[model samples]
Target: MVTAISGFEPTSLSLVAELIGTAVFAASGASAAVGKRLDLFGVVVIGTLCALGGGAVRDILIDAKPLVLTDWRYPLVAVLASLVVFRFHPALSRMRPTMLVLDAAGLALFTVVGTLKGLDYGFAVYAACIVGVLSGIGGGILRDVLVQEIPAVLREDFYAMAAVIGAIIVSVGARWESQIGHWTLMLIAIATIFVVRMVAIRYRWQAPKPNI
Candidate 1:
């Protein structure tokens, strides 16, 4: 079970999750830029896009101002990550799995955040869950499309589904928040998403597709 925290006190764990998600998503985007033979500026731009694009889309959909435009910290985190990757790309190349793991964590966190945000804005639980999935994958889709590649969520394993499940947990768990603490429920949901994604990556699991 999972739930959203109301009156959102910025918990240390939640802050860390946000930072990790921003940094690793930035790293992933930077890596994509490298794959496309992009220059340093391109890497930074792509990284920033991946870090903040999802949240931006989520905000827009919910009729909120884009956080990236209002929050310096969001882009700051992304810039720092982009700089690190730009300077250490050669070494970072060997850390692909670490990046993916971090991305999984980010996905989980964003799913929770997105769903909660939607609920806060008066969306129904299921709609908020859908928003959560969008918030988890929107940035990656933007990054990949910019790089001229298919969005990984559309082509691969449990990437999108993992986030969807996490969002669903958050949506449903709100009903049981009194029985299970909201924070605890949120943690459980995040863990479920991260584990599901990691397992899919480790086992090379892919969603079944049409043979045609």
Candidate 2:
């Protein structure tokens, strides 16, 4: 049975976190589509897909209804985000550095939420890890598909690896009984992913390509 986390009502913190993540994800997708000169409808589609794709897939895999569908706020958050990107196209165009940082933050936050949700559903740790990684990369994959490019997750950057690292930290932290362990692990994971991503971008770090 699906059980909700108690005492963590969908208060301001949770709502704000979700909104921020959704907006960044949507902005990234819309920005990519706009760069390709896709139609307005196409841009919106990409934006919505990027915002909800990950959560949708995770929900299905976990045998639960997507939160995006159950809660109207998610779509609203996505649409609003897309509009912001669309309206400020020129300014956003030059914010590549800012966009990368936002993406990293979204990746870290989503990974932890996915892992925790999986555990709440009584899934095994291995399954939780898979769900976490999928939730982190699913949106980007959908974005690439809409733009007709190879998904960034499959590229040489540490996209999925960063998510996995974050998920592992959360999972391991939950195993220990330290009182603030969960939050500490989450902060650490987010920081690690952000720092690692920035450094990788700076140094052009990449996974080894096949020698075939």
lDDT of each: 0.88, 0.81
Model 1, span 1-212: residue lDDT tens = 13344776766767777988999999999888988889989999999999999999999999999989987888999989998998999999998777788888899999888888887788889999988898989999999999998898899777998998899998888777788887878789899999999999889888899999
- Report per-prediction Cα RMSD to one decimal: 2.4, 2.4
Best by TM-score: 1
Summarize candidate 2's per-residue lDDT along 61-97 as a digit string, tens digits.
9998998889888888888888777778899878888
Candidate 1 ranges with C-alpha deviation above 4 Å: 1-10
In model 2, what lDDT does residue 206 have? Answer: 81
Candidate 2 regions off by >4 Å?
A: 1-10, 177-180
Clashing pairs in 1: none
Q: lDDT of candidate 2 vs native?
A: 0.81
